[model samples]
Target chain A: MALEANYGMVGDFYTQNFTTTHTGDGDTLILNLGPQHPSTHGVLRVVVELDGEYVKKAEPVLGYIHRMHEKMGEVKTYLQYLPNMGRVDYLHALGWNWAYVGAVEKLMGIEVPERAEFIRVITCELNRISSHLLWWGAYLLDLGAFTPILYAFADRERIMDILQMVTGSRLTYCYYRFGGVSADIGEKFISDLRAFLAQFKARIPMFHELVTGNMILRGRCVDIGVLPVEMCRRYGATGPVLRGSGVAYDVRRFEPYSVYDQLDFDVPVGKAGDAMDRYDVRVAEMVQSVRIIEQALDKLPEGPFLNPDLPDRFIPEPGEVYYSVEGARGKIGVYIVSDGSPKPYRLKLRSPSFSNLSLFAELSQGTLLGDAISIMGSLDLVIPEIDR
Target chain B: MATLGQTIKSLWSMVVGMKVTGIEFFKPKLTVHYPRKEVDNLGTYRGHCDLVAREDDPLTPKCIMCGICVDNCPSGCLSLTMHVVGEGKPRPAGGAGELMLAQEVILPGSIKKAPPTGKAERVLDSFRLNYNYCSLCGLCVQNCPVSSLAWSREAYLVGRSRQEFEFDLLARLRAKAASSQGVKAA
Candidate 1:
């Protein structure tokens, strides 16, 4: 029987709305996967048309957590908007912070000091490793391996301690200011980071042994949800997602922001564009992140943390600039239009999760409902970032 | 024979996974016994922004009631009312009150004058900080001219309700002043 409901009623609007309808004759079932489900990673609603266990069609309904950050940029001054960047992608906030700061600096032609550049490189890379660790744990949790996350958090807590020494806050960090970082990295920060690096290096082998080499994990991830390089390019997927598709296009390597050009780090690429390949790419990327941090620490220079000439209330010249940084998930771009005012004329955050999650509806077709969850996990969709 | 070999390889992979778990089992436990045990917080751990008292006079806050922090606060969590001391009234004694008397008065005509009778002085009446809305961005602390705002080391700060988080800086200053006076007297 057709589940009949009043067309005009508020709650029945989704069911009664004119679109693809599956009556009793057609056995296809329409399922709402979230807006609250733990696997969606945040408040993300995925409406999937299911043909038995396989997904026939899928559509992601966003804007549940949308705060209209673009509108906020128009209203708030440049300095006021810094906190919002961290809140956008809490996992890889430093990337977003770098993107926005880099854009403004480019627009205003501000030269960041040598010491500040090195600090940015070190802190941002550390944040990237922390983000990847969380993703590793959460993804494994989604795949029904709970203990890995406990181990992941154990390492993550130490990194957070190191980050907290410099950034002040553990999550949603607003460490980076207009010209440079808010505070200088002390001796404690450097020593803690070195200790963390040593311990993390020893832990990586065990992570590979426990999760990566597992037969069950390989079975679930190996041939499922293949995202081709062409599809990734079309969808504007960058970072690990693009690398997982065998594209070695890392923004740090290609564009070279802050002190990334000075640092030596290899971009890890996967051969096959499957979930397992994506997983391998991220795990490999973590090792590369550690290498980058070590190089940055060795080359750390001495200078003023913030630009002396930069005023407290900074107003950039009337121009437009788009700055992109390679975040944990993908490329985070901040496009700012300045009208020679303290407030931005228009600020648009080209968050990576938005672009990466856009390819999901296309990728999940004809795949088992279970595989769809794995694909979503691999994507590392920060829903607030997507909705922002 | 090929299928059997594949099964053997899968079993070996499972063993590899189990080996990792077994090693972890023997390793020292990472979990901390919460409430009983606590991790040490670094000096950089920012809890909440608190008003800093003057080094010379422990009771007096270094804040000049300039309202720069109040204006610059992005979240609008900080608020302070300026109390204008009426002419001929005896200046309130003690730290914050004494500082109010010493506060320089700037007239609209670009004239700077010291506090006396018939001269209106700006004093911090009540500094209200809504900690609930505070992002703890440290912008206010960084911007304070006299360095009156500092990150409080109160890491274990908790409140039952939203109203409890609304802190009155002036009252805190007064309480601090009284406590220090008691200590000095004793």
Candidate 2:
């Protein structure tokens, strides 16, 4: 150990955490890749064992940003816990919102209005686009490219602006209520979205020319940190991670939540389960999200957004239900157990980031030090969601 | 497993990447220098909870001191202290229908009465909101029976300490009421 980290910071939490695993004796060096490491994207401290420039083994240490969101659901009433969904995975908050609302709706057997379903689909897909846009930009930022994030934000800002029109908050949007959305999307919202899509569709090719097709990016990404389909299944990886591994198992298609089945959009799957494959899958998926939004916008039904004849209280009968929606990262599931109380007896959130990050140990083995960062970025780990 | 042709194609893609950035360099910058020019069109900005004045009375907010918002608040950021009028026990703010006087905090601006305004009329005591813990979830606004709670578009809500944020809503309401009345008189 090269002991010159004497800036009054003590305690070897890395060694303490890596007790079962190898903490490096001599030739192998132990490096903690941050609870706040810039490239880790969040408070994700990856204890990676290194042999010169190559990674020998990697272990992801979590729970630095735990907020006990599931426990909060147990104490708070059904309606009171609505805002917490926004904070869960803020990049794709609508997915969590739909998950929680859908779970509750299933328990109570509440029929969401047709217009509300369409609105939910349209808004959620747009949110998926925004989420992926952020990841794409942030992923490039992690890989040392600065310009792509700025360009990505230019488009992401537009999506957020359109979302902020109806959702009120730009980032943590608590728009969806129990039965329906908080507000209806006006004509201006639809027009703004249409214009954005038209411009964005043109810009995707530009993105390819700038970053995707670049030699430097391809050199770092292609055939690097390859995750096999079996490894993905064992790790419980869903969403783009699983899709990138040649599995077309999208929750929106396989489990048909919302109006996704009614709408037509191809799930992008990659041939090789590598970093480049994951990157390409996310990029292509954004286009699919755009298609979903366009279709939902055209088929926006005419009816009450919120259901009429509401119950006096949100007390669901003694029951349990599991509901899942396809998030930008993976499958966002909420399993609720109700003892006929106003609050949930037990609430559990199944975030995709958690499952996706679990395979880092297996994937990062024998890869270059820099390639680990690429693989982590491709995983699209939202640290808070994992900690939750 | 990149072939010679694929390698050459990827190398050429670097030139294409440069061209894309070169084209973008001439375009207008997307970001703005904040503090120099503020953002406009803040109509949808949900800042904090503002007590909506009653339809009849400008000074008095429609909050019945019922403390529904307090009970319903997920985070215990809200606390209300109201003085019982005559010979009643020190019950909670919203327990009775009597006109309640807000204790400790001075009723300046529009609500000038430290004592009871009248026997029939009800006035609120201090409705303390610790903005430090407030998530701005709008649960309080939705649960308010009188529809007296609403989100204020106050963009520049800055404070020095944690205590600075634990402000009384009644005082703010009275001040706003007085300022509006002053504008009308002027």
Candidate 3:
């Protein structure tokens, strides 16, 4: 019944082939890779038809981790529904937080303080760095490389420590308020971040030495899961996935939100849209994120993190606004419609992992089973975000 | 099948990779063996919510019975039982809606009656927090008008059953106050 729900006719084998029902000479082997597989990374099931060792066709079945988050927005008040953003894309929870608040801020015409904007940029970039670090670890772990993940988590722990000091929660942070952040960055926050950055900058070269130049990674990744720029455009994939396809498009750069226009950093792009290219793009992007944070810290001003003037009962005027922020995976979007009531009339979350994972169905066709797995890993999918 | 140059480069890369791992392995371990020797910096760790006690009297909580925290909670985890005096209209501050004040609390010294105002006065009987359902979004702490709600550092909050997770925050505060008073008296 679940298979029937995923594919129109499960007994008929595939939509592409006209076999009149199950018996199509039995050349292909049907493989169900898992809603609980380690490589799928968080309850993502993909059913593929295999012609010997190569995948003939692939179908990705979603909704394993669905929490009905969009419906949650309609029932709950604006402030009440704010924490749902954190769980949507937990790796880049702050990005979702920014998108939701940014949308609400735009709808209500709420002005964020310059200092608050700077703080948002700093924390968001720090969060972006952390998200990328986890991806780097997890992606390599999927490709049968275990050591890189250990290094990745070691770096991630430091970021969690720095973020937990202010955000209160290490993961699923609901720290950013409508006009500004929940807590002000302390003196210790600045010093700790600066120390982490200085220490991290020296480690990037070591990462390049350790994982980037490894021959085994290169053999598995290079030219495997080759997603061209046009293919990425058709699939609507953004962030590093699209950037790895040699597009310099970034929400922070193209349509500069917050204080990204004020800050200077490069949008790292790659030549070939392969697993290796995405890996290189992410590593370079991490360097760029570090630069963005350092500059924001240098210009970090002193002010109220949360707007004191804002009313306790925050109700946006009857209108709709769509806000997009550059998350670590891709562009995170939040579309909110308010009816001048405390609760939102309608709310929609546009997660990048959904779009990035969409390309996998087309990209995995005719590839070896192992290479297809590598391609999926390259997408850096957070299943909860995709299923949300 | 590969060229000689390509093979040498691959071999060199593998060597470099091993060298990086070798260096990292020699460094002191970064992981914290928790539960044995707990993380030293539990100060920033946000575990659960607790009502902030008044500086003057530790037994007394600063909550004005405004019920902002209950109203602000998304998960509907927190519920307060209040004892109302006179015809219950709104209090001096933002008093909550008409509630079924079914059972009265037996705890003495917890109640504070209004000072001859002849107005609607609400006395907080119990502040029951179902931590099992609590999302720890910090809405209670942030919406607090009297600055009474705070994040407690009870990181290892383990329970045997679902009922054990249902926290009576007022009782916990009183126990903490009594313990401190006992220490001071001793």
Q: Can you give the DockQ of every candidate in the order shown?
A: 0.36, 0.34, 0.41
lDDT by residue for model 2 over A1-388, one digit each (tens)? 4355645434566655555456467688888899889998779899888999899888888889999999988877787788899899988989999999999999999989999999999889889988999999999988888989988999998998888887777888888878888788888899989999999999999999999988888888899888999999998999899999899999989989878889898989998999899999999999998898989999998998888756746889999999998999899999999999778999999999999999999899889999999999989989989998
Looking at model 3, residue B157 earns an lDDT score of: 80
DockQ of 2: 0.34
Off by over 4 Å in 3: A1-24, B86-118
- Every candidate's chain B TM-score: 0.75, 0.75, 0.79
Model 1 CA deviation exceeding 4 Å by range: A1-18, A21-25, B85-120, B180-186
lDDT of each: 0.83, 0.83, 0.85
lDDT of 3 by residue, A268-359 (tens): 89898899999999999999999999999999888877676775467788988999999999999999888997788999999999999999
TM-score of chain A of each: 0.95, 0.95, 0.95
Candidate 3: which docking quality band? acceptable
Per-residue CA lDDT of candidate 1, range A12-86, in tens?
Answer: 424533143543346778889998888998899998888899998788888899998888888776776788889
Best by DockQ: 3
> Which of the numbered candidates is closest to the native, going by highest lDDT?
3
> How much is the lDDT of residue A94 in candidate 1?
93
lDDT of 1 by residue, B95-127 (tens): 221112123221122111113335665666777
